[model samples]
Target chain A: MIKVLFFAQIRDQLATSELRMPSSENHNIEMLLSNLKARDSHWQTVLSKTNLLVAVNQTISNENSALQSGDEVAFFPPVTGG
Target chain B: MIKVQTTDFNLQAEHDKLREKSSVGAVVTFSGLVRDINQGKEVSSLTLEHYPGMTEKSLTKIVEQAKSRWNIIDCTVIHRIGELKLSDQIVFVGIASLHRQDAFAACEFIMDYLKTEAPFWKKESTTDNESYWVDAREGDLKALNKWSK
Candidate 1:
């Protein structure tokens, strides 16, 4: 399983902070996102935001980044911290 | 040093700690306060939320990057989470170096990158009881690009 994390506005919108996804196939970040979006309409709408940001293992990541079991993935809006 | 805490920090104590090394000659500190107003709205308070483990890791990396790019002697980053009142201190970035320019540049670099790369969100509560998530500004992303080239 891979650890999926949600932060900031995404967390508030989805009403969750983290969850575990079953490991299957050679899914990349994009695939992971699509899978999450399939959960419900609320997930679909919130995850589909144009400005959505992602990270893999604490590093900023993109859709093409491949995922592996045990990896920690994060999704959030663009940061506004100082 | 990097800390993610809900409690407010002491600026003078943080400065004293950063400047303790004899090699340090210049110290630069930047403190961010929760403002009373934003975008013409009277904000009553702000709720700062962050991913716990990742927030510290991201902050440490930012400080490491700053150390690599400049001749900084030491650095401290403290970010507060949870509810904060108007005008309350929210964040602090302090750098100590042998020269003023490096300290200044490193301090600014950390702040800029922290705003873009860190996983933090601010929700502002207006005086009228309406609360909204603060959107990331275009200018923040632009500020980070200045450091890349």
Candidate 2:
């Protein structure tokens, strides 16, 4: 399974912090995002944000990054702390 | 040392610790405070959120980079989470080095990187009872760029 997490405003808007889904061959962040977007219009709207940031295995990553079983993924907004 | 905690930290203690090395001749410290006003709004309180594992990793990477670029003897970074009131201390960075220039440069370098790289978010509550997440500033991205050149 792939563990997906959300934080900050994205988490507040979605009201869902974590999710788990089965991993498949040739899976990547973009495909996972599309699967998530298919859940509902609200998910579609929030996940489609242009400024949204993603992380794979605790490192900053882009949508093209590949995923594997038991990998952790996160989605959130840009950081504002010092 | 890197610390991400909800409790307040003592500046003097951090300074003394950083200066413990006999070869250290300079210690520079930077602290960030919660402001009473932001973007024309009267802020009363602020709350911070962070990606647990990634926050530490990012900070360590930034400190490592600073060490590689400068002659740093020691460094300490402390970032506060949870709710904080106006004027409360939010973050602290201290660097020890053999000379003033290295300490000063490394201190600023860590702060600049932390502002852009660390996965931390701040939410502010205004005096009028309105609360919102603070937006990332363009100036912060610019600050990080200056170091790369």
Candidate 3:
């Protein structure tokens, strides 16, 4: 399972701490985001905007990055982080 | 030095720790607190989130960048995470230098980069059922662009 995290505005919208999703050996970052949105309308709406950025395992990432079972994916809106 | 933690830090203790030599004539520090309002809405509380291992890494990188560009004697940054109430300190940045120029520049530089590049997230609960987390400020990105070569 891949651990997914939401941050900032994304965290507020989700209203949950984290998510665990089953992944095949062949799962990718793009697929993970799409699947989450597909399952939850709130996730879909928060991620629907183009301003959101994703980070894989702490560093910023693109959508096509490969995913492993233990990887963590975080969603952010720009950097307003600190 | 950079520290990202869930524990609250004392501003005076941090300032004293970084204040070492008498040659360091100027000290510049910035403290960010959980505010009670944004855009006229009342903020009852705020929750800060971060990447477990990456937040410190990013802060170190920013502090390093400041040192490279300025002649700073000492620099320290502490950013808090987890639940917090209004007026609680959220983050702190301090820079010590031989002159005021480097101290001021480095302090502002650290804050500018921290605002746009760090991985911390805040979830604010308002008076109503609706809560909102702040979005990145466009001005912050513009400020960072000035320093990136």
Pairs that clash in candidate 3: none
Lowest-scoring 10 consecutive residues by lDDT in candidate 3 chain B?
B129-138
Clashing pairs in 1: none
lDDT rank, highest first? 2, 1, 3
Every model's DockQ = 0.80, 0.89, 0.62
Give the per-residue lDDT digits (tens) of candidate 1, residues B1-149: 89999999999999999989999999999999999988789999999988778889899988999999999899999999999998899999999999999999999999998998888889999999999989888888888888889
Instruction: Summarize candidate 2's per-residue lDDT along B1-149 as a digit string, tens digits.
Output: 99999999999999999989899999999999999988889999999999999999999999999999999999999999999998899999999999999999999999999999899999999988999999999898888787878
Better of 2 and 3 by TM-score: 2
Docking class of 3: medium
Docking class of 2: high
Q: Once all C-alphas are superposed, what RMSD does model 1 give against the true structure?
A: 1.4
- Candidate 2: the clashing residue pairs are none
Off by over 4 Å in 2: none
Best by lDDT: 2
Q: Over the stretch A1-82, how does candidate 3's per-residue lDDT look in tens digits?
A: 8988886667766786688988783388788878878877777898887988888888878889999888888887776556
Sum up the clashes in candidate 2: 0
- What is the overall TM-score of model 2 with all chains considered together? 0.98
Please list the C-alpha lDDT of all candidates, in the order they appear: 0.91, 0.94, 0.82
